[model samples]
Target chain A: MKKTVYRIYTSIIFLFLYAPIGTLMVLSFNSSKTRAKWGGFTLKWYSELFQNDAIMKALWNTLAIAFLSAVFASIIGTIACIAMTGMKKKWRSVLLGITNIPMLNADIVTGISLMLLFLTFGFKFGFLTILLSHITFNIPFVILSVMPRMQGLNPSTYEAALDLGAGPVQAFFKVVFPDILPGVLTGFLMAFTMSLDDFIITHFTKGAGVDTLSTKIYTEVKKGIKPEMYALSTLIFIAVILLLLLANSRSKIKSVKTAERGKS
Target chain B: MNKKMLSLPYLFWSIAFILIPLGMIFFYGFTDKTGAFTLENILAISQAEHMKALWLSILLSLISTIICLALAYPLGLILTSMEVNQNGFIIVLFILPMWMNFLLRTLAWQTLLEKTGVINGILSFLHLPSLNIINTPYAIVLGMVYNFLPFMVLPIYNSLAKIDRNVINAAKDLGAGNLYILKRIILPLSFPGIVSGITMVFVPALTTFVISTLLGGSKILLIGNVIEQEFTQASNWYLGSGLSIVLMVFIIINMVLSAIFDKDGEGGLL
Candidate 1:
């Protein structure tokens, strides 16, 4: 009886969580232009999403920003993690706490704060500003993810590589890089998604003509429903789902490989 | 190459993007149009409309956070009890929704809860009363909970997953009742997750203008809405920055309070 109760309760929670997205996906196929009614089933919106220049432009902008910001964040964050290891504990903690600000502060504040900085510098509020804001928030996620792997490092193997006549860069690449690669990849993927889903910061920092799917959707909602909005969202939702599944399976395979390595 | 040299780029990035931008908030927040320091902008939270908005944001966010906590704890316990330990799958399930463009999902709710929406349509089909809660605080709270529920669940479930089954079994063997075991063992161990979940839910819910905008409609004004308007519509950067500082104070208070509970930041997301 208790088990039945738990099962029923769990299903209910999952239902609550997924019902909206599922409905949106279903609606994407509906022939209805208005959200209030289901006009019938149709695939018109899916094809229309490709032809809609505004959405296609926003999609291109979103992907470019998510990809570029993730790449930069991973590089900067990984280096910072490495450098912090050699620093005095006091300064390291201070920098780490500073890193937490972008993560912990309200996104609206972070958005506004960055906006003020750009205003002061007379920077154009466009793709670059949005990219800058994304990278700022993205770095902390990379740091938090990568720092754990860095802490779990076995130092002697790295030193052994160094003493065996490998250069510092060579030693790191040979020994230290593989262990932390997972964390770095995880951080990179996280940063990418954070950028992909970011509306608040992008909304604040983006200027005329540049729109991510998120900011575009926000404006579209205010103006009234566009049929392509549902199609585009469904596509994004599917893309995210695939990305996460790939990440999960990759990690699982890695863990299995490591477990076999441990046995050997 | 000095190992510290590797951080030079990060240092420059942080100072330029992180520290200076943060300093800019303080500068704009504390100063007026002439670049002179003034408390009036910071004190704008006291205006009747601004105060109402802030008060409502806090109240609605609190309600949603509490609702999320109550809902998540039971679900976390049940999921943990099912022995789905730290597998990447369940987490992916929770996280997938969060990553799905939140604007679309929340706007979907606006449709689902509309007067002639899916729910009302279903209710009429069944000869039941329609849920007329859209465009109200309840709808806003629901939006907050929907958007942030995953944030609460993941942390709580992670912390709960860390509890050893043996300890709980040992407590049970010592004649502790289920309620007693929950109170004495499970509750304290999950404190970090709970605290983390609260702040995770609270801070975002507290400052969300979008959720209120989409779900509550233009009739409702949250502090986030007020600040957003000050920047976008009014173009009052100083006042916008000033009001943001007030939000930051609340966020800091939340972080400090959670820090007291989860000192090692154990309440962090999975």
Candidate 2:
């Protein structure tokens, strides 16, 4: 009896969670533009989604910003992690606390503050400003992701490489880099995801003419329920589902292998 | 020795991008358009409209955070108690929605809750009275809860999953009943996750302009909406920055609370 209640409750929560995504998927195929009526089942919106120049531009912008910012953040954050190994605990903690400021503060404040920075500096508000803001907000995620791996590093291995006459850069790439690579990759992915989903900061920093998918959708909603927007979201939803499933299965397989190794 | 110089680039970046921008906010917050220092901008929060918006933002976000906690706690309990493999599947399901652009998801709710939208359509088919709450504060709360629920869930689950089963078993082996074990054993141990989760939900919900704009019609204003307008529409940078300072106070308080509770940083997103 108790189990049944839990099951029903879980289902209800899942229903609430998926209902919006399901609506978007269903609406993507509806021939009618309005949600009030279904004109008929149609695939026109998906096709239209590709051909739409404005949205295509926004998509390109989104990808570029996400990729560039993630790459930049990873570089800076990884370097910061490396340098921290040689620093005192006090300064490292202070720097880390500074890093958390962006993550903890409200997005609107970060957004507006960056905007304010651009205005005060007389910097042109365009793609670069948005890119800068993304990198700023994205660094903390990369740092947090990489810090643990950095902390756990076997410094002796790097010293061993150094003692064997491998140069500093060469030693790091040979020993330390390989060890911390996983964390850096994770940080890069996290940064990428955050930049891609970002709307508020982008909305503020993106001045006239530039638009990401989020900003475009915001403007699109004010005009009407464009079925094309739903189509875009559906594609993204499906892509995320597939990628996560792939990642999940791979991890599961790895775990199974580890368990078997333990038994053997 | 020179390896320490590797962080110089980041140090410069932080000073330029992070530190300077923050200083600019203070500069703007305390100055007028003429750039002279003044108390008027910071004091503007006491105006009836701004105060109303601030209170409304606080009230609605509070409601949303509480609802998210109420919903997520049981779900976390269920997830943590499940077989380890099964935990991943449900978590993936929960996380999938977060990948979809949130603005779009919140907009989807606008369709689902509209007068002629899906829910109303279903109600009419069942011979039930149609419900309408779109473009209201209720709709905004719904948006907050829908968008931020995952933030509440993930941290709580992580922390709960970290609890040693032996501790619970020991409690059970003692004279404690199930409810007592939950209250005494699980709750205290899971406080970090709960605190982090609350901070995660509350900060975004409190500072959200997008959710409110998408759901609550223009007539409804949250502090976020007011600050956004002050910058974007009114072009009053001083007023916008000043109001943001007020928002920052609340955010810092939330952060300090989480910092206190999650001292070991067990459940912290950082």
Candidate 3:
């Protein structure tokens, strides 16, 4: 009886959590001008969204920024993870704590400070500035994601590789690299998602005439919630769900393979 | 050892990209408009009203964090107990909103909370009077909770998933009640997750401006809003930097205090 009650309560909580999101998805196709009224469904908003040049440009900019930031963050973060793993544990902890500051700090503050820094540096607000700032936050995320997997590796694997006549680079690439690939990929995807979703940092750093989807969404909602924004959101949500399913299945496959290896 | 080769790139990037920019932000906090760095800007930020706003941000974040933890603890319990397939589905459902645009999610709440919005529409349909929910602190809390609930849930779930089932079974065999086991065994063991969740939710909630701006209206002010006003509105980058520094200090203090309270420090050890 108690277990059933618990299950029912969990469902209710989940409903509360998902209701607004599910509602937004449903209402994206609502033919009514007002969000409240449930008029007949129509596919007009999505088609309208595609035709808007401004939205298209913004979406492109968002993708570009997300890609650039994720790639840069992945490189820096992988290097940092490699370096940190060799340090004394205490120093490693301190380094990690420092890296995590950007993640924990208020986005508004970070955004403003970065803006101020750009002004002080006499740099223009555009692709480079936004990319640099995004990378700052992204690197920490990547590091956090990658560090665990790095630590989880068997220490003697590298030793065995070296003893087998492999040079340092060869040993790292041949042995260590393959083990932490999942962590690296996870970090890359996380950074990509973060860059895609960020508004606060991008808002402050973006130059004139450069509108990312987040900034565009901010402006549109500030004016009024439009169906086009909802349509865009629905599409973005679907894309994320698809990516998540792919990542989940891929990891499961890897897990099963690992289990089989353990059995052998 | 590849330490020397690796250290070069790590040090170069950290100094050039991370340390320099951070130093510039801190340096600018001390500089006035005359191109000279001064302490005047720091003093200006210490005014009474700014202090109140700082306190308010902390208090509001604390309240929201508490409420989120309340919701998350039970939710985490249920999630951790589920089969892996079901757990994965629940996680997707939970984390999906986090992937959606933050501004849009907050806007969704605004649409739902307004007089003609979904909540009020439901209320009126149920023969109840519509109540004002937007442009208030409550709205800000709602927005924060909505935006960050997953951050709280995920960490707790991660910790609970790692628990040894034999510990619970042993407690059960020893005649411990379910409530006692949860309190003394599960909750104690999950302290790190609780800590991470608190930091994840509380830190962001403390500094959220977009949610407050969209939902809390002009009446509601957080430190984030004040920081924005200083730089963009007031054109006082110095003062804004000071506020940012103060906010950073407060965050450090919060982390330390949480660590201390964690006793084992697992909550804050990270």
Task: State the lDDT at B226 in candidate 3.
Answer: 88
lDDT of 2 by residue, B1-270 (tens): 696688798888888888899898999999988989998888999999999999999999999999999999999998777555363676677767877888888888988999999999899999999888999999999999999999999888988988899999998888889999988778888888899899999999999999889999889999999999999999989999999998998998888777877875444333
For candidate 2, the docking band is: medium
Q: Pick the TM-score winner.
A: 2
Q: Which of candidates 1 and 3 is the stronger one according to DockQ?
A: 1
Q: Rate the local accuracy (lDDT) of all candidates.
A: 0.90, 0.89, 0.82
- lDDT tens per residue, model 3, B96-183: 7777777877777766888888889889999999979799888888888888888988888888988999989998999999899988
Off by over 4 Å in 3: A34-39, A87-94, A154-167, A246-264, B35-39, B45-49, B83-87, B265-270
Clashing residue pair totals per candidate (backbone < 3 A): 0, 0, 0
Superior by TM-score: candidate 1 or candidate 3? 1
TM-score of decoy 2 = 0.96
Ten residues in sequence with the least summed lDDT for candidate 1 chain A: A239-248
Candidate 1 local distance difference test against the native: 0.90
